[model samples]
Target: MEMALCNIKNPNELWSLESCDELEQYGITISVCTDIFSTTILWMEADNNDGDPSVFLNHFLDTVTRIGGCPQRLMVTPSRENEHIATTQTFLRRNHTDCYAGEDSVMGGVSLRSHMWIHTCTPWKICFADLRELGHFTGKDLDKNLIQFCFLHIIQDHLEEFVGRFNKNISDHNILRSQDDGPAEDKLQAVLPEDIEVCRRRCTPRGRYPCDETLFEYWELIRTENGWEVPVDRFTALKLYLHLRNVMETCIDEEEQVTCIDEEEQETCIDEEEQETCIDEEEQETCIDEEEQETCIDEEEQETCIDEEEQETCIDEEEQETCIDEEEQETCIDEEEQETCIDEEEQETCIDEEEQETCIDEEEQETCIDEEEQETCSDEEEQVTGLLQ
Candidate 1:
């Protein structure tokens, strides 16, 4: 961007001043003031065009005086006495008697500002479009103050950029008029702001007049109230942007918390299902072991019952054989008793027969004793021997 200088060599010299035609587009009105001597853009303003005209004119004069001494004369477009610009001119003439102000056509029926507009208006249309695209300002009912608040710095930057480009190149009108003056490049003149002498050096007024207060204070005031209204200035618009940013951050935090809760619940359900599966498997194994034990006990009981039945049968057969042998021994003792009784009866009968014969022989021997005593003694001896034999 070109460095700005108030190129006033003589503070008392008469200077001519004029402005380009007002360009209004996209709910903004722009006006530019050019110094006739150096063809420099001394002041430019972008606004809603509804402000008090007196306020605007005062700021313009103050800005001019700050950069250099106020111009000696000022020329404006033709207007009726009742219109805004004409009223402002009347007001200036009434209050400030030092400046000689009149219409541009006053100089020999030729407008001084008509030729300057041809060069100035071309770049302005392009700048306005660029501003719209960059700011995203669409539709007819646009929020003019919000756009200004957001993009005011960008507007100033673009103005500086245009100043740099415009100062380096020669205008087409000047090129045509200087055709006889050799090459067009040689005719180009660089008007640097540093080279110009002025009464003082101050900040540029192109984008500085809109807002002057600190924006942080404005935002704090609105946040403390926790409420909003349609913004009437740049300060209020900035506060609205900050409030909306806080709300968006809170919503994002809540969404993350809800997602975490859902993940935890899903994991809990999976754990419960696995525990139930483990229990079922243990019960099934217990049932199988019980069945195997019952089958073994049944086999042992059957073997014990078969051994008891065989033992009882063997004891009954041995008892029957012992009773038969006892009965046969009693019958043999009875037969020996019967044979001894028959032998005792036969001995008693033989002894009784011998006793009867001895009695008869004693009676006969007494009768015969008188006759033959001697022969009887000898015969008795022989008979006794024969009888004994």
Candidate 2:
């Protein structure tokens, strides 16, 4: 039920699957069915030790596919060189039909970028915030740069196009390494393309680099000189935690919550529901054999009792729902009233401002008329006094 991760040092370390049957039957157990898909993923570093892993990868894919396993994500370590990365990218695009190019999907690739400040870092390039914070590369794992690159890239490649090319030089390299006194399986190294294509067409113009700084810091510590010394604390289920938190916030306020659906899981659920209906029919037939074909009084009485209980429960639920609905309506009315009150207050304020301006203008006009009348009367009096003299 859980996605198992082997927490060990070194990308060259041989990773194997344990449960084949149960995993393959996942579609049967899950109710949904249309979302299953296969992503032909290649994992391992080009520079991690001197071992060939092509045979192992081919075997892994074949085994998994045979048992009904479909890969949604193709997680891999960083490509050996820029050209190798480009060749791989191009190959995946031309050959791998489902190369993810969206910025918001979970089923695409996870690539490792070489540097932070470089522009040649593919438009879909996964860059690091600070090299010191990369916690997953430790001791021998430090040299396992490609593996670290893959993890970071996965987080970063939310929707970036990768450039890939074929390399002709490292073609004859052995796929497996030789341990002391024993020969072990080697890593898979591919022949990358010589020419690369920049994949800008599949990207968004405003897409930004990986943004979670805290996660980067924790991962950087995964590669310690003392060998990935991360604490083994109980980790919370990210979904349950996030969902509960979002619900509480939503209850008190209003905001959109983020969600995702695994296509495989959805398909499995649909399959399960169909299977359940078939099982229910078989169980009903078995019951008929034991109870006879007649509509017995006991069966009718039991059905009536169950129906009554359901009806009562429904009534109670309806009552509670009605109360809640009324409360929501009241809240809506209160909001509308508040908005209306504010509009009225704004209109009254404007009217008062206009009245103040009009009053000031009228007072100025009356004072001007009085001054003119006084000047005219004074001038007439002066002319009469001069004629009498």
- Could you give candidate 2's per-residue lDDT for residues 227-270 as a string of tens digits? 54332211221222233334334643532322224555667887
Relative to the true structure, how large is the alpha-carbon lDDT of every model? 0.46, 0.35
Name model 1 segments beyond 4 Å from true. 1-23, 49-52, 79-142, 164-389
RMSD of 1: 31.7
As a whole number from 0 to 100, the lDDT of residue 366 in candidate 1 is 51
lDDT per residue, candidate 1, 1-389, as tens digits?
A: 01112433222222233333333444444445554434555555555444434434544555444664344434344432113333333333333433343332122112455555446545544644654675534434333443444434444445556666664453544455456544422211122233222211221323443433344345336556775654443344445544544543465478777777877777777777777777877787777778777876776677667667666666665666556555555555555555555555555555554554555455455545544686788899999999999
Could you say which candidate leads in TM-score?
A: 1
Question: What's the lDDT for candidate 1?
Answer: 0.46
Model 1, residue 271: distance off in Å is 57
Give TM-scores for every candidate, taking all chains together and pairing residue i with residue i: 0.32, 0.20
Error of 1 at 256 (Å): 28
